[model samples]
Target: MKKMFKLQWLSVLMLAFVLVGCGAKEDTNKETVSKEDQQVEKTSYKVKDDRGVEVEFNAVPKTIVSLQPSNTEILFALGVGDKIVGATEFDTYPEEAKKIERVSSSTTFDSERILALKPDVVIAYTTGGDDENLNALKVLEDAGIKVFAIKSATSFDDVYGDIQQVASVMGIEDKGEKLNEDIKAKIAEVQAKVKDVKAKNVYLEISPKPDIYTTGSGTFQQEILNAANVKNVFADLKSWPKVSEEDVIAKNPEVILTTVNYTENPAAEILARDGWNSITAIQNKAVYFIDPDISNRPGPRIGEAVELIAKAVYPELFK
Candidate 1:
């Protein structure tokens, strides 16, 4: 009987694609882990978070505080979101997130509100170890809060590891294993679709013109493009670098994808770039928008990012 429930929940973990990255993380939802799984064995558990923040859990965390959306997504997917007593203002995916107490933001964290909640654990993110991130961790740790810092993630596998970390802390390893299996299955499905397709040259823009920031190697967008059988034009660059329009024209990308959503028409705005009409993407009208949330969130919806790119770069394959 125990084996059967374990198998069932393992499958449940896969079906839920709610992963989160809490840095600019400045960042969703899915089925919960269920109340029945909330019961934890009264045993000591110790593990290190991504940042090497060693955490010891004497018992399951009863009141968890998520400082970013990615941690929030991971917790929910592990079937332990109900334990969340506080989340950042940016946490929104499963709709139920909106109803939770808003406790932090991209620029500032309200230590007072967090302390008020008396969370058993506070999961946070360190985006390249900025001053704010360091201070936030210090403030909470100094206050006797068991804060665990999840390092800034760069790929999908990291997200999976993160889910396991959170689930382990919550004492739900079966659900975590199942969730990893599910995510891998979805990724395989995405890859299968693009296996034989010819790769297209792609350029991903997180922000619009003037300060166009594009990802190079070691970024999630590059992986999505790779999975979708598309090549990134800026793969030669490292990290998120500000790119010049002249270089983009030289790259001759066949498809242009942007996460920028400020303008009324995202595609049209890309099409209107002054010197970009000569680019292959503009000439063929292939400029498209991918929800920044899906591509950049570092959670379960990563498979959705691959699917969307596959369809955009090679519509025929999906059709």
Candidate 2:
């Protein structure tokens, strides 16, 4: 009977060892899972927008809404176009943005439609004041949606920052850097070609006719003019300024670049202006019409805008 008891004890001891081994294996697996969870938790998405507002995301946004056309262009350039579920009525680039649901207009925001769309994030813009749109966006923010507002860009660096901000929000910072580099390289190439060429005095007309408007210093258009090795005749002025025809004719710019597209033929209209026969640009037929969409937007296509301006100003050199 004592021998039998010893054998049973040995069997029990082996079973206890097996159970302990299994428990240790199970505990190791739990530890492995815990580490993986911790690693995922460590991955974070955060960006400070041009407004200096810190935006955080729980994960890469699956649905995005771009309130500005420039933001739409940047998102498409970043290859996150599919994620854009909503955009402004003015977003007409990439041909696909037009198909997206329009949630806002130049002067109106459809908060109800945007809320119904249930976007993961909304990309907005501000002109550095108490924007009424911010009040509308606040509703989205209260609804647990992320709103990132980018300030209006006044320089190429600002444009780059805007791109990086959008990219960071989309979790694609590498692509944003590459896009900015590509733009810089293209601009550099054009700059090198024009470095030896004499800089031309230019009058860039943002609007034409009775009331004329042009960009001056402290504006992105001025930067584009600078990159093209051209001088804005209105650079002495700050921001966008309304100038009289008398002032423009007096400036007598060597090249007149107009981004006025509301009319059928902006160049023709400029040429037909009364009492403007003495202007050098009109005399030399140097009034070139720039695509307002491209030139005006502070987005990925700014390089193209610079090249267009350069080509218009110095056709011989670019060719």
Candidate 3:
């Protein structure tokens, strides 16, 4: 009987050992899984501007508001039109952009209306004497709305940078980089063709109403003129200068490019003006019409503006 008891005790000790080993193995397996999950993962990106300042954002913003037409156009070109929830009423380009909720017309906007949209970001241009725009945006900001003010771009590189800026905001840095490269190539080709050509004196008319609204130094339109190897007659002017009929005739530009929104026949319209026939542009039939939205807006489409200006100023070279 004593021998039988000894054997039973040995069996019990062996069973306890097996149970403890199994429990320890299960604990180790669980610990291994937890450690794997704790590893860091990369999900977002960082963008630095010309100033070397970095801004970090989460995933691509699902809801965006373009407080300016320029911003709306850039967002559309970046394929983020569907993500935009609101824009200014003047955002008439891309045809489909007009269908979005409009925040304002021209320089006037509604702060309360924009506040209701609850956008992840609001973009605007601070160049056009629209201090009221800043004020309206403050309303959104006070309620925690993210406002991104895009200062007016003054050169070709500035346009490409603006694309990168917008793309970075939309959380698509790769797409922006590709767009910048494509624009740079187009610009290089145009410059190569027009390098030896003479720089023509040109006047870009924004409005033909009471007088003429022509670009001055440090403006987007002027940048396009510079890119096309044309010298702006009003380059000396500091602001968006208004020219009288006498003033334009006296300047006598070699080419006159007006926005199509001004009139259906820009050439006829310019020639019909008093004393305009005396100008070389009218006599030589160098007058042409460009899209107002593209020419005026400092966005991804500015590259197109350069091409259009090149064609208008020196069609022979481009062709």
lDDT of each: 0.72, 0.75, 0.65
Task: For residues 159-178, write the lDDT of model 2, one tens digit per residue.
Answer: 88887777766666567788
TM-score of each: 0.85, 0.85, 0.76
lDDT, candidate 2, at 228: 90
Instruction: Return the TM-score for candidate 1, rounded to 2 decimals.
Output: 0.85
Residue 184 lDDT, candidate 3, scale 0-100 = 74
Task: Name model 2 segments beyond 4 Å from true.
Answer: 1-44
Tell me the lDDT of model 2 at 68. 78
* Best prediction by lDDT: 2
For model 3, how does the per-residue alpha-carbon lDDT over 1-319 read when each residue is reduced to its tens digit? 1110011111221111110000000001111112432311223544443323343344446798886666677778777788888876667778989899977654355666667788777765443333444555556677887676655555666666677777766655567778778777777777788889999989878768575667789666677788878999999996467778788888999999887463578767876777678889989988888876666666666667788888889999866
In candidate 1, what are the lDDT values of residues 92-173, reduced to their tens digit? 8767778889776544567777777899989876554443565647767888889877766677767777777776677676
Candidate 2 at residue 154, lDDT? 69
Q: lDDT at 307 for candidate 2?
A: 92
The alpha-carbon lDDT assigned to residue 62 of candidate 2 equals 83
Clashing pairs in 2: none
User: What TM-score does candidate 2 reach?
Assistant: 0.85
